[model samples]
Target: MDAVIIQILNGLDKGGAYALIALGLTLIFGTLGVVNFAHGALFMLGAFVAVSVNGLLSLESVTLDPTKLTPWGTPAEIRTKLAEEWFGTFGTTLIDYSVPVSIVVAIPVMLLIGLIMERGLIQFFYKRPHADQILVTFGLAIVLQEIVKAIFGANSISQSAPASLAGTIDVISGVAYPTWRMVYFFFSLTVIGAVIAFLQFTTFGMVVRAGMADRETVGLLGINIERRFTIVFGLAAIIAGMAGAMYTPILSPDYHLGMDFLVLSFVVVVVGGMGSIPGAVAAGFILGILQSFAAMEAVKQYFPGIDQIIIYLVAIVILLVRPRGLMGRKGVMET
Candidate 1:
């Protein structure tokens, strides 16, 4: 029973990441009507943002101490974090909670990147073929990844959760879970809920939905639907950025981190339906749980290496069973 509960928690934690990434992918598709293969690169950039913030916070100054000598008679060197020297305890706190702090910085940075990408490149592809969209965006993704590799190198950089939340919490009798994972799960829920609320209840969202359904009619109604959709693209980038930033403590990030999650997230997007936000979220959690269960010893004994292929296997089965997915619209992506 405890093991089952633990696995469920693990599933939710993993699902939160999948859902967040998939949600961004769906938003961009629904709003822009453009396939963005570069979306994963945005996720990678977000993780790098966190890494950059931490590096900035930990910036150090080196000084030679004349009073202290090394074994070889050279002066000892003293290294002090500039943040700590300048801000004292607050700086220390900032360093400890860098992951959460990075989210604040990622918002504006990612929004700007999204807007630039949309206006500069994606706008040109609006009337292009899907194959063209895929090719160009894939090329863009490679360029971005190579840039990251050049800057951060190919090694994985580790990030630690805040010391305050680094330990485990008891969820039930004989079941303990890491505090950060729990925080991440709730954080994901909060973000997802906030996005849904913004779309469901806001005037801006209503107009955007109308645009999605009948873009020509909305344009004829004197609404700047194109502008709004551009903002939606920025919003999607922010979502992916937040997910990647928060996930750093859970997964050490490397230059190719975005590529790692790219395919799985695309799978989630497809399974959730081409443009269905609710469907994407649902599929992410469902697949996450199934993958977790498949990784268990009991399940592995019956089916070797099932964990390695569970998500893809389930995606195939789901696509075969429900052509339009669990909550997909009747005409969406239909031939």
Candidate 2:
């Protein structure tokens, strides 16, 4: 029973990430009818933002003390974090909480990037062929990946959770889980709920949804639907960015990190049904749980390497069984 609970928690942790990414993907698809192959790059960029913030916070200033001599050395050198020196305890706290702090920086940075990408490039492809959209966005993703590789190098950079969240908490009598993972799960839920509520309750979100349902009619009604859709793209980017930033401690990020998650997220989107927000979230958690169970030693003994292929297998079965997915509209993805 404890083992089952542990696996369920593991599934939720993984599912949160999958759901967040898939939700963003669904938003872009549903709002703009554009296949954003570069979505994953946005995620990678968010992780790098955390890395950059941490690096900035930890920047050290070196000084030579002429009055003090090291053994066999002419002078003693001292180094101190510039942030700590400037802001003292507050700066120290910022550095310690760099990953979480990066979310603040990432929000504006990612929003700007998303807005620029949509206005400068993506808007042109709005009526283009899906193949063209895929090719162009994929190319953009590669360009971003190469640029990051050039700057941060090809090595994976590790991120640490805040000192306060670095340990495990007991969930039940025998099940213990990482505090950070639990935080991430709840964070994901909060973000998800916020997005849903915003769309369901706000006038702006209502206009966006109306535009999504019938863009031409909405525009005919004198609404600037295109501008609202552009904002939706930015919102999607923010969601993806937050997911990546929060996931840094669990997965050390590299240039290829986005590509790694990109494929699986695409699978999640497909399994959830194209442009279906609820379906995406549901599929994410379902697939995550299945993958976790498949990774168990006992399961592996019966079905070697099941964990690696489990998601794909489930995706295949789901697609075959329900062509439009669990909650997808009947006509979506239909030939």
Candidate 3:
């Protein structure tokens, strides 16, 4: 029972990320009918945003302290962060909370990137083949990855949550889990709920949904469907960036972080069904849990490498059974 609970929690932790990324992918596919292989790069960029903010907050000013002598009797150099030097405790607070604070920095940056990518590049491929879209976006993803490697170097950048969230808490009398992970899970839920509410409740969301159903009809109704779709693309990028930013504490980000999640996110999207938000969310949690359970010692003993191939295996079976997906509507990817 304890093992089951632990695995379930672990699954949720992993599912949060999967669901978030898959949601954005679904959004782009549903709205633009473009297969964005570069979506993962948006996630990587968000992590870098956290890294950049941390670096900014930790910018150091150095001075020679005549009063403080070194062991060899030479004057010692004092180095202090600019934030600490200028704002004292306030600067310290900023540094401590840099990870969460980066969310603010990532939003506009990601939105702009998304908008630029959609308008400047992706728009050209709207009438092109899916293979062409995939090739271009995949090339873009590689370009983004290389750019990050050049700037930040091919190394992982570490980030941490606020000190208050750095420890573990007991969910039950005998079950303790990392506080940051719990926070991340809840934060993901809030963001997901917010996105869903926006889509399901707002007039804009209704219009977007209608456009998704029949874009030509919506355009004929005097709605600027193209503009709305572009905005939706930007919104999708924001979601991916936010996910990447919040995920830094859990995984130190590398230049290839985007690619690492890209394939899996695609698998999630396929299993969820193309252009289905609810399906994406549901498949994310299901696959996450299945992957978690497959990692168990008992399961591993019976089936070696199950952990690695669990998601793919499930995808194959699901696709075989339900050609669309768990909740997929027909004619989505019909050729």
Weakest 10 consecutive residues of candidate 3 by summed lDDT: 326-335
lDDT of each: 0.90, 0.92, 0.92
TM-score of each: 0.98, 0.98, 0.98
Task: Show the lowest summed lDDT stretch of 10 residues, model 1.
Answer: 326-335
> What is the Cα-based lDDT of residue 177 in candidate 1?
91
TM-score for candidate 3, please give it: 0.98
Q: Which digits, one per residue and each the tens of the lDDT, describe model 3 over residues 59-111?
A: 99999999999999999999999999999999999999999999999999999
- What lDDT does model 2 reach? 0.92
Off by over 4 Å in 1: none
lDDT score, candidate 3, position 183: 85
Give per-candidate clash totals. Answer: 0, 0, 0
How big is the RMSD of model 2?
A: 1.0
Model 3 error, position 68 (Å):
1.2
Report the lDDT tens digits of candidate 2 across residue range 200-257. 9999999988876788899999999999999999999999998999999988999999
